[model samples]
Target: MLRLIAFAALGALVGGVIVIAVGPSTVGYTVAGIALPVFIIATVLTLIARSVGNAVGASPEAVQQAKDARRLGVARIDALRQTGTQINDQPLCELDLTVQPLQGSAFASTMRTIVPLTAIPMFQPGTERDVAILLDGGPEVAFIDEGELSPAERARLRVPGRGSVPFIPVEPHQRIVDGRRRGPLLGVGRAGRPGRIALFTVVAVAAAAIVVVPYHRAVGQSFAAMQDGRLRPDLRRPEALADAQRALEEAIGHDRVASITVAADFIIVEAPRSAGDTKTDRWTYRDGAVTHDGAATTQPESTAEQFSWTDVALDRVWTLMQDGAEQVDRPVGDALAYVVRATDDDVHSPAFGRPAGPPEIMFSVGDDYGTTSFVADADGSGLTAR
Candidate 1:
């Protein structure tokens, strides 16, 4: 699972880079049209290979049984000897004979006969002798006998008259199949750590390509909407607005919020309420007051007192800047235009009649374009040249 996650992340990274380079439009079609089917095919093939390999591999027990059957000693009963036969130092009840082998020492023909003394327990015709037979041929077939057998092991030898030797004494790790030897199983394949890592990396890259393209396209659409001013005003909400205010405040350190006023044709900057600072660049709006080369100034009709204004006015300025600055191609210059709040003595505007709050023209404008300062009326009549 960890490998899967890592692979996904790697895939996403690769996909994202591709999105940046090629544009999201092409990536989505390419992955959907080409990558998906290939991934499915590869996965199916891998599973099939694993299943077939397991089916053909030998079981551990089978392999061990084969080894046990090939041991130098165990012999099968071919035929019984005359009751009074004598061999070098022992009495033999049966004489074991062999078929001449086409190949040297093949187990296929070697266990044909056994000679044992009358005192020894003889198996019914086909049971193999448990004693170790000499590897080197000898007169009377020298066999070494171990003392006794466990009752459980001896009980297994009681099957009557089967032509083939049904039971062969087995060693540890040998497989018994109806008391016959078979095979040791083959190894199954497993992905090593490095191989697994590589696999995940490939998968992640593939997945990332599939996912990132669509996200890239969505972001592009959002950016285009933002640039066009067609986005919903309340889309982000109060939090977006607040975050935008904070960021603007920080950027324009020491500048009062009330001092900023949106120009009729200006840049608007703001944040959406729900997302706040996270999508500040995407959802925020900012509007600047429009200025022309020789714009006319407004003359005040009366005098008024200065007063602090709410952030509402600043919000309007941002909205207006986003909406208003469309075809206005003013020359770029070193001049900086700034909205500066009016001092008590400088608040002059016709709209500032005696009112409930300290009535004043809300804001003033200053720019490096000229030394002359000006004030803007609440209605945006024009800049009042100072």
Candidate 2:
């Protein structure tokens, strides 16, 4: 709940500030267009974190689903659970659902809505039949266990033309991933016309819109100044980072940003606020940081962007990513891995060099199988993983 509140608050603050600072502009083109969308995204993230956090404790419906799939019925095994010091990519009972292109966007008209399922009987890392599902109105294909499909198995589906069809969709088309496919997917009944799937999708979009639309409009307003170039990102300069920190502390009201440190490209604000093993993380950029002695903490007078540079760089990347977006792909239960290259003098490349000296290129990359936080440092580089 706190996480959700944080997200909503962040959106509200950012959006509200943008809206007020820039006044009102186009209703369509503003960040408000994606406010609800962004909040919708934040909500999804929070729910996912909560769900995975609560994976060990099975809900009644989930238990029943297991029972229904069992011999006597999906029997309730005492929610078998185990966690590790690390994260893994292998699904407990990895299931990949390959929806045809159209089935995926629902609104898009290219492919039939295929709801492939290699779904786990349980969400946690446990044991169940590794399956691949095909939802062509009904279960079009089901890969039993976690094995390759035999010729006979493939032939059973009466796949017309092309003769051979992949047992499962690979790469981009494989949509349903990890536990996000939890709860239930939009379903379809017999006739498939009054498609329950479509209905569910409509309801979902509407529900999401109710929240997303408002959030979208509100946010666009928040960043209106920046978008207009009037409120340029202050973080573009190293000194401006301090000013942003001062402003943030003032906003938190009395909350201290005393521990906040400024980096060339980023600001590390050591906000100590938690009683548990973990605490919340807040990321935002402004004009300045507040201090107790009625003055700005670090540099006296600096630029204004603060850490806002990240937003621009990310946006630029997103814009340029349009063309090749079709080529990139991931597994059903896998996630999109985005990396940030190193930039300081001590920073190294993400790849290895033949004969290294003071410089080493290493990637602090992560994927479904946890993280591969390794550096491509050579013998004489004098650099090590931190």
Candidate 3:
């Protein structure tokens, strides 16, 4: 679920970068880093699909639930205080406010998933609230935030229409005195279908463009590619004169090409999305000497060969875990991981190291990992892994 939210939110951002690169008009005017999609979310659609679920929801289940629970719980509390009801204060389950929502989509992030709940109120700023509300009957005793009693503006704030709502529970249903509406209620603000769709579209594109693309590509090239159709400069290629023709072909795959470059003798290949960050080592003729760029490096792919250890990282592993940024219920199963051999060395010396192996791949869904995975076909061609 977290993965879904991450993806959904990030997908929009990734999609955003793509569209933003396409046209300035696309990203110039966006709300937050998101844009609404054309269709309603599957959860919303599904909720709407079931008549009972929709009723339980549109009727403000969150609001009503909060209300009812507060009522009953308060009633029990009052009874306990007065020494009356025989229903001794039995320990009911602790009302857990953290609701694990149903599975969301690839784009749903923790913030995005919870964005829906934003509509249900009594859950907001500047008010006394129970850690968990109980509904039933009686004067509810809630731990009020200091602000509720603060004399700051208690005199000015009033209940809408009916004037003042005394901070009393005479009418359990109206226990929550609408003291200081604090401006019009945002939950009541309705977003038309068109506005919703537009918002989704904007967010989707933003995710694709900003979050995914930047992380996926090198410093300049990734941005240049999407925005200007310019391929990231394989810095390892240097002048491009030594292998101009092959370099051009190696650069453009038309179809997907799984390849990585180590600064070794030649490049190793693979069929994974991460041909960019696999840990790698390079040993080649550069500047004027066959110096080693570094004994160890972390990247998803390698473009050099023979003395390349791109596959060194293949032994290291990657997994999809919790990202507080994402809102998910379960694990995701489609995260991609890159494995490298570091360098390819034929010499018996320890420095001669093992030849880099093809990159390993992992897929993820939100916080889950190790589910569906596939190997890519590599041909030892194209740009060196950054």
Give the winner by lDDT: 1
- lDDT-wise, the better of 1 and 3 is 1
Candidate 2 C-alpha RMSD relative to the actual structure? 26.9
For each of the candidates, the C-alpha root-mean-square deviation to the true structure, in angstroms, is 20.9, 26.9, 22.6
Off by over 4 Å in 2: 1-14, 19-386
- The 0-to-1 C-alpha lDDT of every candidate, in the order given, reads 0.36, 0.32, 0.30
lDDT of 2 by residue, 313-352 (tens): 2222222222123223322121111222232332363323
**1-386, model 1: which lDDT tens digit per residue?**
33354445546555655454433435545544454455455555544433222121224444344234432234455555444424354543433423111112323222212244454556444545543222222111223353333455444433223333222221222223433433334222343557665667678867875766445433443454466574322212233344434545444332222223233212233222122112122111232111122211221222221223342343433333222222122222222223433334324734433332332233223234433333344433343545
Instruction: After superposing candidate 1 on the true structure, give the runs of residues whose Cα lies further than 4 Å from its correct spot.
Output: 1-6, 11-339, 346-386
TM-score of each model, in listed order: 0.25, 0.18, 0.22
Candidates 1 and 2, the one with greater lDDT: 1
lDDT by residue (292-369, candidate 3, tens digit) is: 344343333333422223322222222122221133444433333333333435575443554343433332333333
Q: Kindly state the number of residue pairs that clash in model 1.
A: 44
Q: Of the candidates shown, which would achieve the greatest TM-score relative to the real structure?
A: 1
